[model samples]
Target: MNAFTRLRYRGSFMMRTLVSRSARLMRYCLLSLLGTLPLAVCAGEPVSPLLSPHQTIGTVNCASSTCHGSITPWEGSNVLQNEYTTWSRLDRHTRTYEVLNNAVSQRIVRNLGYKEPATEVKICLDCHAHNPTPARRGARFTQSEGIGCEGCHGPAADWIGEHAVKGITHSANIERGLYPTNQPIAQAKLCLSCHFGDESRFVTHRIMGAGHPRISFELKTFSALEPAHYRVDADYEQRKGSYDSVRLWAIGQALAARQQLDTLADPKRGHDGLMPELVLFDCYSCHHPMSDKRWTPRLGVGPGRMRLNDSNLLMLRAIVRAAYPDSSSAFDKAVRATHLAVSTGQTEGGAAPLQVVSKLSATIGAFLPRLEQQNFSPALQRKVLVALIDESAETSYADYAGAEQAYMAIVTVSNDLLSHGALKSTPALTDALARLLKTLRHDEQYDANVFRKQLSTLRSTVGVQERS
Candidate 1:
């Protein structure tokens, strides 16, 4: 099975049976002891861990034997106490900072004319490590730990002491300043801050030009790829509420679109010298070989015109079309207007005018809350899946980025449907998914015709009929 297929956690079945029984007994005992405790009242708005005012105690503080550092999943624990072990032993996040010391990063640093090694550079460290102001660093803090527990969970100084206490609720932990990682909106914002970029730490075209890989992200897929440390069992849902894979994917698309527009609207980040940041445009648009002849009239601009990276926008548009058809036309109009404005402004070889970018940004901003709040029902998920396929086939996935996003969307929605029993998993469906992924495996070799055909095959295999 591909990475898209869910894998069971590594352990023997007999051991798992014993562990489950023990866990149940322990959980019952704990509940009996704490049934009278009041739930924690949520306090202020969520804040990013990096910006939290509290000092960051080191990973060492979080990894003691009695804390989150158990060698295996602790029976009856609300969380996998072995989170520290899993992260250190298996999570790529643990290696993020270390990657800066490798040859590619060294070359990127050199290409950018920086004298400092990538590890020491502020820009590199911003996302690679849990970097904060010196005052926010506790005595135990060390940067070498890369993205540690506090990086995503917020500074541990305030909440670490009582978070695991017998009667403390999850919300109580949040009140004390634990970042709400379980909330989809909050998770999208936090993940995109580094995965896509935010006002503070963005990957500029300059950085990419210097050799950084183009950033690609889809929340649901990436979260699964993270091989999530915690299981979403009944206990987890009782505490954190339900987990909806499709809803996360939708919110991720909307927020990603909004974030891109917001970044483009920023005067400082949007322009580099006399040009709009090249990173804002699809990388493959200008990079592809002249011999490929992949250009199409789908974007409503003339051939050879630079195009904004609209993968997220395209995905979001499909979502709106499926879930809120009344808003679809308006959203489409805004996207077209932005593209036209960008084309017009870029004719002069500079950034799109701020007014133009800001208008579209606000339009997306207007649609955001609704998108976030809209429940992605099984029917809605299926409709969105069909809409995505229909749009991709009609438009022909003109850019590689959009095609990549489409593939992730298809997998995410399909998986959600399968989980809900709306679609059955089969060898044919599995093979179709793998083939679709293969078409996108190499951006340089991507053939739109092949991709469109694979999309059709997937649609048929999953029993979605072609539109009349």
Candidate 2:
């Protein structure tokens, strides 16, 4: 059957009843559950049933009155009365249509002369639709409700019907369809399912060519939607009681996602007729043409164009030093390249406008010979792994302008190390981590206010104690 018809059949009765009664049924069940539980149990406000497995996804399951479908706007809230309409019309998630249908996507397809921009069956539905139990998404199925709730979270069909009935326990929820967002591994699995496709799938042309934000997704920052879809508050005695698991899950997800992206982005393969070096550079990185056509590549992927203006490679070198002090040449070469990039960029007339990129290439060239000369020892490889984690934690890309490309480069290098299993087992890895944390602490502006809130989330998520 065609994709559209498949959706019609699968949607069936579940969609109409589930969506229509969503909010009221959820609140009713939540209130009842809270009433029974002791007051001392501080799980704050009833969780939106969307998080529960008992709620159907992609079946018009959000239409129930007083639930997401409530017609009378909830008190003073401006939330749309019908979540289905709101999600389809107002939510950015639905706008994937504009992205696929846009001129740019068309242009790329024309340039490549492919039959389509996104393969209707293989690439499109990977992230856009849902995956239900007892029925795997066929090779050709493409359900609408693009980027449906279940696309990010796991399938709910198994538990959506069973979770809310009186006496249905959380453990049972876990067994049926529930994916504990609080668990780092589970959260990572759910997210990487789309952002970084599983082993069964290959990165699609659309995902690879989409501009900036569209090209990549971050876990720590992007997962903020949880606050909207779930209960997250600082009012409690311990914030841990609320956001601990979700937050840690996000951090782990970020780390794992990066590793996955790096693994798939084999500069060695050189897909799309580009060199390994070119592949290593994110699409926006070198394509960015500012005044005088100084084509600087994008530091990070995606719409925000966030770049962390720090010596990322230098930091990676530091990680290498901490983990494998013997790899002094590799570490030093990275440091020298970073310093040269900065000094050259600051030259007269903005460092000769675009000559800095050439100088940067020269630095890499100088390092290649040395890098190639020495075989990576097990100890050295371990250091590279430690460096990856340390560098990732040390550097982040948040805002658009003034992002230090050096640190961004370090992020790429670190990701490469992690993907290669550099830190599989070694004492240097532990030392490098401690060193990275110490560096962040000592640096007055390391965890700036803007990042502190986010970092705090990571700390809680990882179950780590606050630094004294």
Candidate 3:
């Protein structure tokens, strides 16, 4: 089946399975333990492995080369003397608070007229704040520092005490206690923990609510944001001292996490609400106009129930119209179709999902011809490239079917970019895209036919239609 059809059928099956599993687990627990055990005992079970905001920020931020400490760098890549200072002063995640405090965020909040719905209602803190754990760190935790190391890697306290020894270095510290980006599952879980939200542990919010979905995390596409510290091999095993480890970890993690989500099937149970907003998928894959409500990041609210803002969809359409002056009618039809698909309430897996793919294909068919006819003008072709990228949007599918679309999107966009003169200006983009394409092309577990066709098409299009 095509990615579109498979997405819908598989998604539906996965949802039912997830709900069944959750129910069965609950029933078994109730019969085996909950029925006999006290409420406190069940509650006492480790609710979440995630550290509290205070413990994470305080511990991670305090051991620094630039802010908390006197001076000097650690491991060459990071400063050991002033970690907090470096984070607070320069890190984008650290600056999320400033953005939240900005006039734009306040205006959105005022527009929503939310009467301070509690810590969970603080939308900005959802992705920014350290996730709180039952083991509170007294008053040491501060919410303003944004996400800390343990936020991504997990609480280091358990491993920290052991690994901090002067002469001891346990690989488990790197492998088990904290997420080693080396482990594909760990890396994906780490990212999805926040981006998609752990339904078992926290609520999930939409991506648009957090501001820019395009800037948000998608398994395959977002790997560019993280530092790959491991080497990826054909075995998909971790190799020490290979930068490629990071890339391997990403592919494995993305696939594994997406597969796990597919196993669950439903977007409602656990943290299904944490799925990225579908419209964000549109923005990422298609670059069409957004007519949804404006996005405003929140604190404490897990990325579980995040939804698209209608107004932003409108704004995006305006931008697309401005970019493709003659294709306004086509763009309008595509956007309308997209809106209708979104309104159809397709879960992570369903027929409504296929409609999205159909719409994207339609848009691409309309614009790609224009690019070819116009001799692939850098400016005009850029729009076509953007549409191609948008065509790869897989919000629901990524959470269910896998990151295949995302990877394809990257590969196609990179080709388009290189064809349109991006390689000369931005060599790194070219290199990164090339490496990713190579990995995708070679990965045995991935469907070779899809990559083969896409890579072939992309190369042929660039070679024949563009000026070298």
Model 1 Cα displacement at 413 (Å)? 0.8
User: Cα lDDT for residue 245, model 3?
Assistant: 17
User: Mind giving the per-residue lDDT tens digits that candidate 2 earns over 37-57?
Assistant: 001221322222223334344
Error of 2 at 448 (Å): 18
Clashing pairs in 1: none
Task: Output the number of the lDDT-best candidate.
Answer: 1
lDDT of each: 0.76, 0.38, 0.39
RMSD (Cα, Å) for all candidates, in order, is 9.0, 17.9, 19.1
Candidate 3 per-residue C-alpha lDDT over 185-258 given as tens digits, one digit per residue, 9 for 90 to 100: 34555566555555443222232333322222344334432322211232222222222211322233333333
lDDT, residue 289, candidate 3: 23
Model 1: lDDT of residue 181: 82
Against the true structure, candidate 2 reaches a TM-score of 0.44
TM-score per candidate: 0.86, 0.44, 0.44
Clashes of each: 0, 32, 69
Worst 10 residues of 1 by lDDT: 3-12
